[model samples]
Target: MRGLWRAHRWTVASGALLGLSGALLAVWGNPVNTGICISCFLENAAGALGLHGNPRMQYIRPELLGFFLGSAAAAVLAREFRARARGPGLHLLGLGFLMAVGSAVFIGCPVKAMLRLAGGDLTAVAGAVGLVAGVRLGIALLGRGELGLGGPERPAPVLVPAGVVVAVAVLAGLAFVPGALIESRTGGGAQHAPAAVSLVAGLVLGAACQRTRFCITGAVRDAFLLRAAAPAAAVVAVVAAAVLVNAFTGSFSVGYYDQPGAHLQWAWSALGMGLVGLVAVIAGGCPFRQIIRAGEGDLDAATVCVGMVLGAALVQSWGLGGTTAGVPPAGRVAVLLGLAGVLGLALTRKERIA
Candidate 1:
């Protein structure tokens, strides 16, 4: 136990921070079990940008900008901010798009799935299973040399970081300007903690995540392929912290029926999250990780982030998002197609099997 603690102390700390912040975000005013949803925030931000016309989902989430800016700040301060691009840009973007689709179908990302579970939503169980399966599959392919992403990573122009930083600044500025962004007055998007509070939460979590490299899918990957002690410890820390906070705040509930922001389609949820796991492995991080990497001037990750926003917009505009009632037919088909498409893409990048 002492050895495990030393191995994952930073990861555990960061994970606990995320868990506590996630539950408290809702307590402070954000939607239930949605303290930190990358896909949901993308949907809201997309609507705010008029990429989609979902009024109930339109709002500029300061947490998104906070994540980006905070990560950039951390990377710059640590001298880890390198402008680099690798692999096929369009393909990497597709991974991000697929991640958005999967999260939309599951009604949340892996992080939110865990938050839901911490709140005692059993429906998230299927999602957790699917996520692990996907991560395991990704690892299998990677180990077998079937994933052809192995190549020399090329360095991008140093000016790339400047442009990315400027973009983050503009978005952060917009979050503060009155009427600069679309604010939803009716639905989940309308229900949010104070902008300043949410942004601070995102900043602290984002910076911590950057330093610790704490990622949901990455933890799953580590647990499956590498050392289990650290990843397991971090995962437990997140769920335990969230559970404790929820129970304290009267938000914890037993059973899964009628849970907030969740659906009963367990099979589909698994499949959707499975897609997320697969892409995170292929893309080098989950949606949240992609945003952090983008902040650090990784063009590959930046492309994925752009794809995520586009996917978020397309899902709503095309009515491909799941809902409390159930997953839409369109969303279902999209998830199936996304799985097939991403798998095909990964195959194309494969080398020889060992």
Candidate 2:
């Protein structure tokens, strides 16, 4: 098992498998235009709690529950489940919130941005460019020794699993007993793929991602900064696999502007992801990495994940998120605030460069 894990081919293959499976799951009826989005799922879950009233997007997503649990299981099995913290709490939470807000403005995270592109959303191209720009900026900050918040000292071993259990219970309850507060009757909001299928897919993908350490931000960062092609290669494999599946499933549409559930504003899309990329670099991992780390018992990552969920809720509730028609007023303001925050973090940090 160790030998197989150490092999580069195995890692790449697993990443490809994860990407293909996630895309297929989306095509199979997970959510139209949102097969596997952590941010989107969190937003949906928040709406399920009556945090927001967007009826078409409210539901308890099984995939998210599967992510934490799958990661926990893998960590335990691999003997790598060590609870730890590295940076400050409040700062991490703030960054996580900003990341979520930025992502909402663009309507996806770095992973979903790639998926959106593969699904023929041209707006994602701009988002991709933004991601690259943000990563580059982060690299520059790192060169100057500009680091953001640090975490707590002690780590709680049970927090992750406990959280997962609670989430699962919530989802199960919602699935079985319809609540008046829960928006289960909205058009795009109330729809969901089969719970069994979504759970299975999340499990598979989570385990695969945990094993391979797949991260979109890290892939781009390593490629540009370290000149290493391995992580980038993994991304290529996933993209290729997803594109193939999308084509096979007749989910492929080619264009930047006319894709489903996407707006044509190129600049904002780019800026939105750029903000995410920058903060992710400062945070020490991409959003996907954070999810995987939370599985491995990293409390800081878990905090970030929590912040992301809250941020999603705040964005949707305040009308700060984007839609297919265009960027919302609140979303625009959130983007501006995010950009300002990043710049402030960069400028205010006192670091000693070698």
Candidate 3:
């Protein structure tokens, strides 16, 4: 299949897979306008674990575990399961933290932004622009070749099974342990597709994504920095397919106002996503890619994932995230701070001009 993908238009295949997976997820029961939001799902999972007391958003989503395990399976099957854990863990941790915070403020990741656009949310346009602008800035800095983190030394394949084991244990607990995980009494947390459907969709999407190395941030970055269209083609496919599905399925509603779990604050949306994009590019992948990398045993990616979960908890607990009313002042301030931190990191590196 991997070889076949290489022979064919792999980008289209990947994008189609993502688009279909997202549409199917929505049909299967996720909240309207939200199919497979990595950040949002993580936020919900954090709430489920009692990491946050938001009763409106609590559920031990199985999709997170499914994605990790599925990616691990793909990596192992393809012999791409190399474990590399080098570089500054604190840097990755902090970047991941900022990535999560930014996404929380925006109420979505790059994927969600795209999905929102596909669902006819014009508010996501600003966010998408911010993402592109952020990537462009990262590309400019990357040209100087100073952004490389130190490389990993040893391969820790054991982390693969360890991660899978943890995922399985969590899934089992969510399934069998009554009240072990919190449930949302109302709001977005109360909305969900069945666990089985969501998990299966996640597993399928994870395996496909891992095989293709599909990443929303990477797609945007490569499109701009490397003049690569294949990845971008895949991303476009996701949007096109999602739009078609939503339109036919009656999920498409064009407008920013009254969008599910979203606000009409265009500037905040853009700035928030810009922060997410900037940090994601610096960190080398989007939120979902980080999860897949963790499954493949990249300790840095794992660290980032943990940081994202922590960020999610912090945002909800501290009221740093926005609600349907509008963007919170705290959230906007956090975006500015996150941008400052990312800029400092980008410029402080000692890479010589090419």
Candidate 4:
């Protein structure tokens, strides 16, 4: 496995495969253009658990479970399962929550934003611009000695895997059970890809990403700031593969204002992802990275995941998220708050890595 990852072609090919497979899965299923959105899936899971009563967006996504489990397996096998934390736990939790809210406002994470664009959602282009702008801003902050939140202290050996096991068990139970809290009968909320397929996709993507260190934000950031082309090349590979698959499957539609499950407002889309880019950089990785880190026993990443789940619930409960029309007022406010939070962190921190 290590030998394969050391080969650049293998790593890029695996990433492209993960992206293509995930996109194909979404098209085959009824998740619209979204193949495997970390934030959206987490939000759906939160709604499925009755965290919020958003009927159209409730379901336990199997992909998420596969992600953690796959990453865990890789970590264990690779001897990379180091349990460690660095900074304040609660603050990271707050940042994660804000990041989730911002992502919800845009209706996608960095990965989904790219997928959305590849599927011909013009609004995703705005979000992509915002994401790059945010990352650029973050880089500037780093130049100014702006430090962000660190990790938490490592815990006992049993705690990390035990936590992951508990999370997996809960997700598995939700996948099988169908009660009022589970929302299995609803057409929209209960809709899901076949559990087996979702799990397999997640497992493959997670393991490959763990080996190759694939990150959407890092891809763009490296290209724009560091003058590196490798990360960006991987992103282009995924985008090309996904676009081809989506076109072949009749899933490619062009337009910004009326994409399925996406809003048309260009401003908010950009700002929402701008917030995500800033916060993610401050947090030391994108949402995907955070998930993998959580699997590797980073409690801070776990806290961020919790924040995403809670933020999903809050967005639904407060009507702060969007459907197809546009972002709610509260959702806009959430994005602003995210921007403020990240800026505050950037300004206040003492150490500068850039």
Candidate 5:
């Protein structure tokens, strides 16, 4: 197994691990079809930090903390740990905000979209389609050599931010330290596997992804632009494994109606994910990848993380997120506005020489 990983079979191995982890998370306790949603987990993390007053979503999910620590450990061991600056700061912040907004509008990011589909929510098909379309739009701009961030830092200083993240994780874990923090009493917030299990799963995933440089955005982008199949194949493997596991464990439910944490508005799902796809392309990674990047000491990725938390708060406070009935009018408007913002950025940003 170690030899396979060393030889660059990281994709298949990590994909299988992700699939198994999702299935186990579902069996262990997470909202149905939402074993490990990057957006949802971030919102939950925000709520845990008292960033918002959403009781139902407030809890310190160890999975998120594990992603950071696990990746950091792997990077350090591999001698790949380095801190880098991301430029066009204000623009990157805006793009991150829009990315979160879009994800909230749909109640899922790319990972959740795929997981939802694996669990038999046919509505996710719309989201998947939108994701593809959005990626294609970004590709069009890339073809013109627009929307690039500047070069990497020469002397990378990674430890400081990594230490900060570790501190935050420790504080987050204090939720279990006997009344040190508020916790969700019911619903999705109430559901979770043991902290140890979730954290370990996250750590394994983080390490594998870091080693392989895995990014869902990169997967789609490479598949379309470079005709690369490895990343895309990894995605397929995950989906297949998730589907199989869910079916075997009776976690899979066919059809779309009354799916937990999901609305049936087809157009909103498509449009919301489309917005996510655009911003993810602009930001250079999906939500989870951004988190991993932050763990690796990219300050800009940290900026995006903050934006995502703010976006979650904004949606919840303004009632712009989807509910069981359907997508809210406010969410619909947000998606449209987000797309417009992305378009403006794409046109105005100077082309970067990579």
Candidate 6:
């Protein structure tokens, strides 16, 4: 027990903080089971920026901005902000878009799925299973030297950090200036914690997550790839902490029906998260991790963030998003195509026999 504590104490702390943050954010006015959902928040930010015209889905979330700016600050202070690009290809962008689509179909990202489970939503189980399966599949392919995107290189000094500065300015304009961005007067887009509160929460989370390298899929990935106990233990800590908070906050609802932001298409939920897991593995990060890394001056991650925002917009514009009614036929088809495309990418990627 002492050895385990020595190895996993920091992870446990990070996970506890993350879990408490999610639950408290929900209690503070963010949507239940959606305190730190990257995909959903990205979609909201896209709408606010007029990337999509969904009146019911437009808001500039300060928490989202804090994720980037705060992570950037952390990276800079830690002297870890070295701008590096992945090898040639639009592959990362495509993966990012596909990741968003997958999250849309599932109605949340891996983090949110876990939060939902913590809130006692049984439906998230399918998504969790799918994520594990997808991560396992990625591990298998990686083991065989398939789908190898080459290592990062070409350390441009100011590329990504400069872009992050621009993003901060632009996003701040939209967030603070009236008429600069559209806003939803109703629905989920209208629901949020106070901007100051959310931003502070986000800043704290970003710094902590960056410092700890916390990621839902990465945790699962490390468990498989390195047989590490700390990562998995961190995840368990998240669930346990959130569960305790949910129970105390009167937010725990132990059932599948009428759950907020959930769909009845269990198989599709699994597949959607499977796609998320697969793309996250290939891209070397999940949606939240991508945002953090982008702030850290990883141009590959920045490109992926751009793709994710584009995807967030496209899902609404193209009507490819799943709903509480269930995944539309188009959403299902899109997931299928995404899976096929992933397989194609794997087969076509430059082989590096491991």
Best by lDDT: 1
**Please, what are the lDDT tens digits per residue for candidate 2 over residues 1-354?**
344334556667866876687688777776555777777888887888777777777887777767766776787889877877777778888888988888887888887887787777776888889998999898888875746644345756676545654665466545545563365675655667787887777777777777767788887887787566665676777667888889998888888656776788888888888889999998877777788878777878888888888898898878887888889877888888888977877687677574
TM-score of each: 0.96, 0.91, 0.93, 0.91, 0.92, 0.95
Clashes of each: 2, 10, 0, 5, 0, 0
- Per residue, candidate 6 scores C-alpha lDDT tens digits across 294-330 of 8888888888888899999999999888888999888
Regarding lDDT, does 2 or 3 come out ahead? 3
Sorted on TM-score, best first, the list reads: 1, 6, 3, 5, 4, 2
Model 3, position 69: C-alpha lDDT score: 76
Q: Once model 2 is optimally superposed onto the true structure by TM-score, how far is the C-alpha of residue 168 displaced, in angstroms?
A: 4.7
Q: What does candidate 5's lDDT look like per residue over 1-354, in tens digits?
A: 344334436776776677778877978987787778888887787777787877898777888778877878888899877777756667667777788778887888888887888888888889889988888888776654546354554444667676767786786478458667667898677788887788888888988888877777767887787565655766776788899999999988888776777887888988999888877876788888887887777777777877887887777778788877888888888889888877876677666433
Please list all clashing residue pairs in model 4, or write none if there are none: 85-151, 85-152, 86-151, 86-152, 87-151
Cα lDDT computed for each candidate against the true fold: 0.87, 0.77, 0.79, 0.76, 0.78, 0.85
Per-residue lDDT for 316-341 in model 4, tens only?
Answer: 88987766779988898878877876
lDDT of 6: 0.85
Candidate 2 regions with alpha-carbon error over 4 angstroms: 1-8, 149-183
What shift in Å separates residue 6 of candidate 1 from its native position after superposition?
A: 1.6
Off by over 4 Å in 6: 1-5, 146-148, 349-354
Please write out the lDDT profile of model 1 over residues 1-354, one tens digit for every residue: 467668778988988998999999989988999998899999999999999998999988888888888888899999999998877877777778999999999999888988999999999999999998998888876755534244677899979877878877898788889898888888998999998998888888878888888888988888776655667677778889999999999999978788999999999999999999988998888888888888888888898999999999999999998899999999999999988886775576546454
Best by TM-score: 1
TM-score of 3: 0.93
Clashes of 4: 5
| Position 286, candidate 5: lDDT | 86
Error of 4 at 313 (Å): 0.9
